[model samples]
Target: MADEQIEVLVVGAGQAGIAMSEHLTAAGVEHLVLERDRVAERWRSWRWDSLVANGPAWHDRFPGMEFTVDPDAFASKEQVADYLAAYAQKFDAPIRTGIEVHSVRKNDGRPGFHVETSTGTIDARYLVSATGAFQKPIIPPVVPADAGLHQIHSSGYHNPQQLPDGNVLIVGAGSSGVQIADELRRSGREVYLAVGPHDRPPRSYRGRDFCWWLGVLGKWDMAAPPVGAEHVTIAVSGAHGGHTVDFRALAADGITLLGRAEGVDGDVMRFADDLRTNIAAGDANYLSMLDEADEYIARNGLDLPEEPDARILGADPACMTDPVRELDLSAAGITSIVWATGFANDYDWLQVDAFDENGKPRHQRGVSSEPGVYFLGLPWLSRRGSSFIWGVWHDAKYLADQIAIQRSYQAYDAPALAAH
Candidate 1:
């Protein structure tokens, strides 16, 4: 016999899982949420100490709660974790922390799921995989393993003091990479930042934050990335009360900006010669966003003031002049390397035929093709904001509705079977 049984089971205890629990409870669906660690463990433990929420507090939170900080201010990592915990507590979510799920498979000869956990086994009529998107850190093997340098992924990096005393090379010019590079440089360490394809958006424009403009322009509800393009991380920062991320300013401040890291030959790290090209792409994205916002304002006849300064934050002439193509780590006195190349989905335990060849979940707005299986908290799951806190809440509500509808159908079928 299974150690536990429920009508619905949700795996994970972070924002997505807890949000699922809240919606399930409201729908009167008997469900339990299993968490491997404490509530919002990713926010609480996995992130660096200096990290903050990318969105402003007012916009990033679930609808039911408000942050103690000012609406326009960004929330710290600790504050975000505490907020999620409080949200779960306020609703008395049925969360079982410390229960690690080892595997999940369809139950043969039965219309349900068999879940194997660290504590015991569980059987449920429905399963919602809410483990989130940032599961596994993807660190490329660009640098040799025998380079004899201390290397850590962005997820494992905590603070400047955690690294050895010397110059640092941070690959991947995403938000994490730029932020860490800036931090290290400020701490009196020579930092090398490898630039990559990324969107550069102003933190605020026209007397409002960029997130506010997105919401107003209905950009957050954007269903998908542009055709023939995948989503790229935006180069913005919430550090020091929030500010626009200008690569030119960063370069001027002593952070050596290099092209994308290519490979390593002996002790020399090779970089591409497309630094200017990458910077221009970011600038294009930045200007395009501002143009969209301005068009929206003009069409609506809004009384917002025009901010011309937003358009001027473009490519750095100095960066375009000459970019470093290669660096000898040993000669540069670089003692540490931080790989901020992003994450990959780790659903090896999900023994179901619900994924594409790329190992990505196959779902239509969280509803999987396999019966009684669902996915939540993935980027662009239903819309562009599907992975955000506010977005996850809405997605969870939809999944709960699906579960309730399925239960109703099951109830009808049970009665007819009994009569037969």
Candidate 2:
């Protein structure tokens, strides 16, 4: 027999899971939210000390909840965690912290799920996997383990003081990589950032924040990127009171820009000769966004202020002029390497066959192909902003409605089954 029984079980206590809990409560669903650690543990522990919410407070918060800070301000990691905790408290969410979910499998003999956790077993009629998309940090094995260098994934990095007193090599120029690189460079460390495919949206466009423009233009509703396009990480940052991530600006500020880190040979790091190409790609994305915003303003006849300077493209950075194809790490005094490569969804504990060949959950929005199973808090799960805080709230509401529908159907079917 299971240790506990629940109508619904949410397997996370972060923003996604908490958001799910809020909706489940409103829908009159008897659900319990399980968290391995404190609520928003990732924000509290995994993220760097200087990290801030990428989006402004007004746009990043859940519905009916206002952040204590200014709407235009970006909340710090600690603040975000506190906000989530307070939000959960306000709703009186049924969340069990420090209760880790071990494994989840369909109940063959029963029409439900058997969830094994650190506490015990929980048989739940419905399961919502709200553990989030970034479950495991993915650090590629490009460098040998015996390289004798202190290597850490982005999630493990806290601040410059945590590393050895030497230069830093940050691989993968996504938001985290660039932000950390910038922070290190500003801290008097020689920072080398490996450039990769990324989108460079301006911090603000024509007196409006980039997120505001996206909302007004309905870009957030985009279901998916164009077909045949490579996955490009967003290169925006809200650190240091927010600013546009200009590679040229970063380069001019003494941070060295290199092509993608391809591999490592004995004490040497090889890089692709595509620094300029990558920079150009990011620039193209930046200009494209501005162009679309401009056209939208023109077509709609809105009185939004125009900033012609936003369209001006700057010259290439000096570092890009003579890109380094290889770097002798030892000679360069590079004592640490921060790999901001990305993350992968770890669903090993999910025994349900709800994933595709690519290991992605097969779902229509949050509803899975397997009955009573759902996924939440994944990028582009239902829309472009599906993983954002506000987006997750909406998605959670939909899932709650679907769960309600399932419960109603079960109620209608139970009596018929009893008759037989």
Candidate 3:
């Protein structure tokens, strides 16, 4: 491969890319972010028109920009996308888009790396695969490929207008599944949400949105690692993965929650019996935590502007929804099954051999096995909140410092210390 040399190269220009760019620039580390598409292309393209961000706007915002919407309110996908575009501009991040990375190959003898892209090749001493995790859609192998069911992943969905009429079955009980189920039902489509283990909390409980406290107590950073907590955190590529999205509201809205999908044929999904138990456990966990939160507030005299009446659900459901259900994709003329099933991260372009068998890079708080190469802007990349907007800021600063220190660049070269 033809090559010139550079100090650093970053892949992907989303949140992580932006964060890394800030650090590299501050450290005076020469780096480039290789973006395959327009900045924030996934955010701008994949989201449904009716979809609003699941988290409060502030919690999802990037550095140097304030959340324009109500702190407790949700911003539509468009708004979040626009915010990202603005964030890129604010930092003047050096992101070269429309350059698809073909492969990242380690050099035969050199200590550096090689990046082959749609355009050309570039060599660098450092590579940050900020490609983010939600890389590709995953459909279960169990589902027959021949099944005449409409299947689509969340990444391909834009709005309900694109969906075929009638009932829709959204597989995977993650927040996306629940939210999409909610969206379809509102658009007058009969919806069936297949249930599974989902991590989420209510949008608001006991007069306060969980995020309000997360921001207040700085608990979002509470999960941050004790050291380099900020930079070491992972990125929340999808809101559903790291935080709780209000599933209780999904059930309360009368969305039929089916057990996990057993198999899909002719538009009918067979489900496991465990769905009942799973939902009960989820509700119980939420309620128990809410009770504790309510007590903490009362005991500490915490004041919230508005709190919903909190009630705990019994371990057993008063009535069980039937075990098996079928939504007629053909009858309803439904044309797509949105796999809110989450994304699989792909980083084949990373030339280094530092990745684990699972294809994840082994790093301790964004510090990679490869020296002179560091990563930033990952969800829980280090600490608990490492991926949240509020949580990641600290990580950004810290990781920046680590990179600076590693490079032997002292923060603001000190004037020769005054002689005693």
Reference-based TM-score of each model:
0.97, 0.97, 0.83
Per-residue alpha-carbon lDDT of candidate 2 for residues 258-370, written as tens digits (9 for 90 to 100): 99999988988999999999889889989998998999999989898889988787777777998999999999999999999999999998989799999889999989988
lDDT of 1 by residue, 1-420 (tens): 798899899999998998999999888778999999999999977889999998999999999999989998899999999999999999899999988999999999988999999999999999999999999998898877778999999999999999988999999887888888998888999998999888888898888899888888787899998874585677989998998888888888988889889999989999999888888899898888899889888998989999987787645646557888988999999999999988999999889989998989999999998889999999998998997899999999998998888888888743455554
Ranking by TM-score: 2, 1, 3
Task: Pick out the ten consecutive residues of candidate 1 with the lowest summed lDDT.
Answer: 411-420
Best by lDDT: 2
The sequence of per-residue lDDT tens digits that candidate 3 reaches over residues 47-139 is: 766667656775667656877777666776777777777877876888899999888777778766777879878887777767666687887
TM-score of 1: 0.97
Candidate 2: lDDT of 79? 96
- In angstroms, what RMSD does candidate 2 have relative to the true structure? 1.9
- In candidate 3, clashing pairs total 31
